[model samples]
Target: MPQQPNCFHAFQQDVSAIKLPARFTFPFYYQPHPLAEIAAEQLQQTLLTNNNWQHNFGLNADDDPDSAVGKMFGILVVQDQQGQLGYLSAFSGKVADTNALPGFVPPVFDMLSKDSFFKDDLAIITKVSNEYKQALQQPLYSQLQRQVSEQNQAFDKALAQFKGDASERKAQRKQQRAQAKQTLSEQDYLAFEQQLSQASVIDKLKLRDLKVLWQQRIQATQQSLDSVEAEIQSLAKTRRKLSNRLQKRLFSQYRFLNNLGERKDLNDIFAETPFKVPPAGAGECAAPKLLQYAFEQALAPICMAEFWWGRSPKSEIRRHKHYYPSCYSKCQPILGHMLEGLALDENPLLINPGKDKHLAIVYEDNDMVVVNKPSGLLSVPGKNIDDSVYSRIKRQYPQATGPLIVHRLDMSTSGLMVLALTSRANKALQRQFVERSVNKNYIAEVTGIVEADEGEITLPLTLDIDDRPRQKVCFDTGKPAHTIYKVMQRTATTTRLSMYPKTGRTHQLRVHCAHPQGLNMAIVGDEHYGTKADRLRLHAEYLQIKHPITQKVLSFKVAAEF
Candidate 1:
């Protein structure tokens, strides 16, 4: 590539000695950068004052582990937004070394020595750089070729099986017809007819005349299945081979999940975090693990459907049209919300949450996922050294992913939550909630006396931030909300009430319970919404919804207590 005037750049790295497969020099990068600032004084002046940029490259071991001998030589240096040398990093380049290694020669060799080719011969270096840049796409091209080859193999395999199956069927039809006409005697034919009549289905007929056809078809089907399975296994092997290949060829590194239950290295680093714990007598088959597995399994298909086939708020795809991620600047933890309800590429076997895993699983189906969570746990990863439910779920099932957090429960308020796993279910379930077809109930302990045996708390609520009833009731222009309170039981100091929030609001129950006109009652143990115990004594007791698959009413009941 032709070098730009007054621009020069080189990788700033120095490694005294080298080892294999573990570490690299300069954290070894292969991208280009702007070297104008560090270039000649003229270039530096132009970069800082004029905001001009000149792209460049920094060679590593691929050139020469020590000197500029084997380097992929030449660069087009430039300045970047940060007033630093800038360009696309890790862009591929090449050298004219005849003894170049077959596999990748990592750019671990740093401490660049640029030739200031722009000064020496800008045009020559520019041509060389351009050529090298184009060569970088070779990997992508190779991948495409491999994919096409595999696809062709698969298609041919399938076609061959179909032809064999068809041939067998034709042979069977002819033989069977011939045998029916001439082979079977009258008595034998009568017996055969009787047996055929008794047969539950004509499609399952297995006669000697059709032996070649039936057996051949079976063999062909089995062969086709075996071929598909073999290909699948091979594909997996190829994927596994990639890391090793990349490491051997390019000295690359990445992460993999803890396959056998736990990662020892990770455990050593994070010894404080709890591992998957087994119940005292449950052994390896503990309830938590089983529950988690079953829940994950049920959600696998549904979760996948939402991402692959489900709609998105901005998606132009018809199937993904309804996938609206209720996330925006107004919604705090907005990114977290999107991650759970829109898109999350879970890989590395979903980092299982540790001690603070505060998720209350509400419902699961082939098409949806639901959870009843306490207030403190985040809906996704957030600022307070925490992550939301969406992050954890993605960590478990990396594929078939979507962030359809259909509904959200406040970090503090314990309540039922539902998420659609499939795009279709996402739309249906969302509609169900919007149409007020889903039933939910809560348990709360409120303060003060209650003369009325039962009454409705018609109050709207939003974030009050005020000292009294932080999530307070406002007769003003707050969101419309309502709660039905029935005195479940009462004490001289407190009233255990079953709260049914008719309208979902920020803090309807606590606000209503502590209405100033009423006993000025505050919910027992509600710190934010009221003053009571150490934590809010509220629970999502029961939930009801039509089963996604069966279309039957399914209710989840949890008796409440203070």
Candidate 2:
């Protein structure tokens, strides 16, 4: 095997003279570098040639080669110490229980190394966990649990006996009253009932003594259970405190560096949040590890890419060989701190320019206007983006009044949107929406086949506050959202559906289509709930509403291009 390049000086003079890549690798999102693609192709070819490589990727020869289960491979374009451009590959998580590969860069932290501090910390954690387990298995603890269980059974039996006795006595008293009723007048019967009640008082006194005795037994048993439970709880608390202390110490040891060479420990990274810092290996994702190595080796990072090379996991949707952006839950905050000094490419999706912007006006009247909105355009002006449908329409009809936008489509969803021209029209249209008199239809292509021709989905939804812009099913504190869908077509791997939303909660259609309890499949190209595609495969296809000023029913339909 060829030896890997140690430094830039190790490269040939010709290779060293090549100019650096024009753009720095985007920290969050990126297209693969041409060289990186070549490298990945080479890696794939190499794996095909070597059966051992398949095993390294956790692929069995017997398994289907096209299975979606896969690993994520990242290639970073970098200049060596001699200023020679080359690519270094790394895989997310681990490959075959190892981080070191012949041509790949090493992990930032080697937790697997026997001599590493992480090993010692892990050992301590293991010991603590075993201690907790052993404490539970102790004879005294087992006896206490058994005693609680036995006493509970006894208490139940005693209570049942008391209830049975009471019922029997009441039955006998009722029979006596019935027999006496035949010989007595109504007034006489009432007097006899008083006598029967007086006789029952003695039985009540004896039952009270029995009740007190059982209550005392239950109380004693409960006290014993509480004492044992307290001891068990104390042990758990001690273990947790010890674990946390060790974790804090471990996290403090992991210090990361940005492009500027400024350092921040893992503890510092999570200081503002309510949670304590995660353990030593937190934030050691493929992207961060690659960047850290590049910075340390004085490499100039150019374009980079990360693509899945194995089967997708059960929880998230990841197609084999597809490039995915860094995860927001884990990588966002860390990259925010790490990419401080690098000049980043302008995010094209966020930029909005004035003038020459076209709004496809489908229909317009004195009271309202209907326009077709393209995918990747916002419905209204946001904090950072102002060139939305509302903004464009406002410029076109500057004299228009009230909130022009009557409803919204997600930025990635293309479709027809209706805007009111005046406050009266807006109020009328808003009322129609509130009363669900306005009917809207959306066309979407989802990831799976639809067995059912049509179905109704009702899921309450609320914004995931911690992860902004993403909505989740929240039964406890969510507004009810309903969607009625009909299958329009079905392909081998996808289904096309027409959806009618009863309530216009944000991302209601997307969530309804993606949630397991609902459709159990995601709309194709839905980036938030599904995998990223060229665009979200959803379009607002039709709308029907009563014209506000004219009081005439109006309907509009647009064909979905997809």
What C-alpha RMSD separates each model from the true structure? 24.2, 7.3
Report the number of the highest-lDDT candidate.
2
The estimated TM-scores of all candidates read 0.35, 0.68
After superposition, candidate 1 runs with Cα above 4 Å error: 1-362, 465-469, 517-519
Q: Determine the backbone clash count of candidate 1.
A: 52
**Lowest-scoring 10 consecutive residues by lDDT in candidate 2?**
7-16
Tens digits of lDDT, candidate 2, 44-92: 6555675553443435666764442467777677765554566666776
Query: Candidate 2: misplaced stretches above 4 Å?
Result: 1-22, 46-61, 64-69, 130-211, 273-276, 279-281, 352-373, 379-383, 386-408, 416-440, 445-537, 543-556
Best by TM-score: 2
- CA lDDT, candidate 2, residue 460: 90
